[model samples]
Target: MTLLRDLPLSALRALAAAARTGSLTRAADELGVTPGAVGHQLRQLEDRLGVKLVSREGNGIALTRIAEAALPDIDRGFDALASGLRRLRFERRADTFTIAADPSFSSLWLAPRLDRVRAALGRLDVRIVLSIALDSMLEEGIDLAISYRKSSARDLASADLFTERVIPACAPALIGSRSDRDGAGMLDRLPLLHIDQTMGDDVYPTWGNWFTAAGGQRKNIDHGSRFPLTVLAAQAAISGMGALLASELVLREHFRSGQLIEIAREVPALTIRRRLVWPVDGPKARHAAAVAAALAATAIAEADGPWPTKS
Candidate 1:
């Protein structure tokens, strides 16, 4: 067993270079050292090993039988070292910014608006991971998170992006001329879309809650199909499958395109707060700040616009 402490790296490098090139001058040129230095290093290595590793052959050198036997192992060791260094450099230079978000908010709200973020931070790579688990951000190396939590961890920095208001919405074709009826009566005639509490959050809104808020009975609230994701409920509403209770922020595009109509706007709004969260101390903090600023601007823009009203 040879101790690594006995082998100097400089001597090993010189020996390997000289063995491959077969010339002290060429090895020195490759190593950016003088030919005398290369020769001295090779001699030191031979003395340490107690073996004559090279012999003078014409203008160059030839490896001795013992040196030839060791050459393959030395070459392989250097190649592996070089490969490991390259991988480390590549990993550090990737420059990708990752965000964790709720699936519904990502698909309906943030996904469409990401082009604006890209344009604002040109050349910065952005990745959005949609999940119901807010804790996934911390576990998965996410640089930032769009969270519905009222507070964040002590080690994290957070900015209020926007607050969401839950409201009833349905496809324009589902309404017909029934818009003149009372809120509860109109709600009673339509199948009510419900969002299931599959995200492990006990405080999520329900059709019954919306019905109670609108001064209606809970009879029809539990009759419609249930969906795990709010985006799926919104899509169901767009296809005229049923009327869905969704955040105003998520339904803005649907309203603007006339794909869905806001119903029962007179009902009191249920507010849900959203925030942009990131670690307070990390390599990605600066990049997260820029992304948070862009997201904040988009949120403000959305808030300043007029709420869609029925014509």
Candidate 2:
């Protein structure tokens, strides 16, 4: 055995192959070696063990009883070895998916629900990048994207997942103190907050826009404290920092908990459809479909209303 150890592993491999295949010629073809070479290794092995491992058959060969008895164990060991290598490769590539979305939605809407996604897809590692840039759909590495817009452009296939309605929300205490007063004029007295730092052509609804849409006198819309993200603006509203024009999609829980109050249903609250956007001809569309379905279920569950079918 020590002398055999001094020889190449290819010799043992030939024996295993011949045992399983039951033919020296077939083993040689599979191993990319000549039949004579395989026969030579078998003869060397049989001589070393003082046993007949294989016998000749009409222009071919067959494994002996000893070879037949050893084959099952040898095949099981090789299968396990192959499976282990495959598992290692799968684990190494596990953390490869990346998704991007609006910063506010990422923080307020998706961040809170990621644990469920993680538990559902335990094997795939995920990375979320907060981006207000509209170019994420064109970015090379992003596998999925979420954004708020009225209509999807022709360049991208956007599925409307939910509608984000802008409403005047403030701390319940703030609303309670002013309950007796005319709620429409409350914005003139209370400080307001804004999130307008994103560099894009997309126009978000503002207080003045809502006022004009309602056929009311336009007030100073730009006189409020500005924040860069919707979640932060909502937090400011929750802490009584000021009344914020924020999305109903992100503030539904706060409204339910009485932490925040929706003031004056007359704001004609702008409803912009939130969408899952992806390249029209890319591989990400299938990935986008899964996200779209999850978001659709979330929307229907949270809204307590029939969701409009997506086009």
Candidate 3:
């Protein structure tokens, strides 16, 4: 409406503030303006709308029926406006850095290594946004992504974070001794917990894939409890549901806490690597690179450490 454009948001805000508090002085205090300024805005609003928006009810102020009717929506509109402003502030703040990654990676990996991340980017505010899309992280105002594919997009650059090797692991109670881990013999005894989610991925180390690589097969290993996420599969494995094959990074804690033990360390890893990906050209690029470098270096340091359970 032409009338909508003719009215100033400041005047509308003044009305909302005054209407909510029923006191122009309190409204002015909330808005950080003089009470006179607030009164002037109310007059301006009335003149523009050609309606009586306010009236005197004793010593306190009262909004007219029309203004009262619109108060709830007006309050909600102001709330929405404030929320949008906050998002913009987060997106463009010079000292703020935003990164996105998948849920499993965020919880299992980045969360544990947050101290290192904060140390790497001194004085900068760090934000990690999680998304289900593992391959693409180029969302609006997101500076960096811990993503699956190296950017085929020309506008981005990436650094190797880690390529995971699907290590076969299970709860220790599932099998008796370390002596049985020499080959895929455990595959025969324990129920194989299948993570069908990664079966199509380049790094998905399924029993079938492992069989292809390590040369072995079990009758029912191919079809047992199937899970979508590594965490769920890890839990199933801990419950002694079956043998789960996952990357060391994802299951490092389970291994450390002795909840899950590697069935065999001799098993090879897959080539499905993850990278710290970011924009090639933007103000965010340099900071993204610094943070990515720090994360990569810290990852290397951590990955080189000893495995808790025996091989």
Candidate 4:
């Protein structure tokens, strides 16, 4: 009896490839090995089986009657093996908790704090999908989602992460001194950085709205280069491209590093609440819950104090 344990998987793979392609060179290419290696594997398989599985017919090789009889079963066995491996790989991927959030939130807020969250979650893989569209977490295979708006879905569980305070900020070089303007006048003289409203939901506060809150004329706020994302606007501000109205939490690192400075005059900062949401009952509910907890803890820590001052 040919013991299954004695059958080498590599030899079988080589035989299957050669049988499927009908050429040693083609099989070698597919297997990413030399033709000689493929031939050696075939020889070893045939030697063990004690049968002539393939014979060289003229310039090419042909499978013998014995090989023809067994090829179908060999192919079926490899197919089953491949299917099993694919399933295992997919299951392993599913173990990773996938989160979806706004592009700016993912890049600026979540990414910087990922190390701490990862340390807390130990052995769990976290995947972040940055997008503006609010997709169904269950249907999209997402473990959790962070959104500016609260989820209205009946099947989802939600938690408040943090409320963002939006403020006017600019590169240190952009401001001459505290006397640059009495208050909101500085914005009119300098280029006002605006976040492009079309990229995300209309709920995003605008430079015009901020100006109005600061008791500045709306006409002075409307003119400036527009950025599609908050991160982009923050980058422009850091580069001294213009003065940007941005979230204090999102640009905390920049403020701490002195790359960007908040304007002295305080406007009524826009307050937007961020929420963590997940399907109430799903395959990854436990994993999502763990991730959500880590995120909430991190959010609280961040809200408690500013980022560490870096020289």
Q: In lDDT terms, which candidate is top?
A: 1
Across 1-311, the per-residue lDDT of candidate 3 in tens digits comes to 89666658999999988887899899999999999999999998898879999987776699999999988988898799889987887656667777787667788888788777676567778777754343344445677887766667788788999877567888888777667765566576777787755311444456777766766666765678887777888998999887888877789889889898887555565446877888887776777888898899987887777766555
lDDT of each: 0.78, 0.69, 0.77, 0.77
Window of ten residues with lowest summed lDDT in model 3:
196-205
TM-scores, each model vs. reference: 0.63, 0.58, 0.63, 0.63
Candidate 4 whole-model C-alpha lDDT, 0 to 1 = 0.77
Which ranges of candidate 4 are over 4 A from the true structure? 1-93, 118-123, 197-201, 307-311
**Which of the predicted structures, 1 or 4, would earn the higher TM-score when compared with the native?**
4
Off by over 4 Å in 1: 1-94, 118-123, 176-182, 197-202
Residue-level lDDT of model 1, residues 1-311, one tens digit each, is 47575657888898888988999999999999999999998898888879999999999999899999998988888899889987775575457777777777888778888876775455668777754355555555777887776434676788999878878888878776654322556777888888876442446567777777777675645788888887788889999998888788778778888888878766787777778888777777777887889989988986777876556
lDDT for each residue of candidate 4 in 1-311, tens digit (9 for 90 to 100): 36596768888888888887889999999999999999999898888889988889765588999988988998899899889987786687666877787778788778787776675455768888754344456656777888776667788888999888777888888878666623666877778888875412467677767767877665655778888888898988899898888778778888888898777464556777778888888666776777788889888876667553422
On TM-score, the leading prediction is 4
Model 2 lDDT, residue 75, Cα = 70
Error of 4 at 224 (Å): 2.2
Candidate 2: clashing pairs of residues: none
Rank list by lDDT: 1, 4, 3, 2
Clashing residue pairs in candidate 4 are: none
Backbone clash total for model 2 is: 0
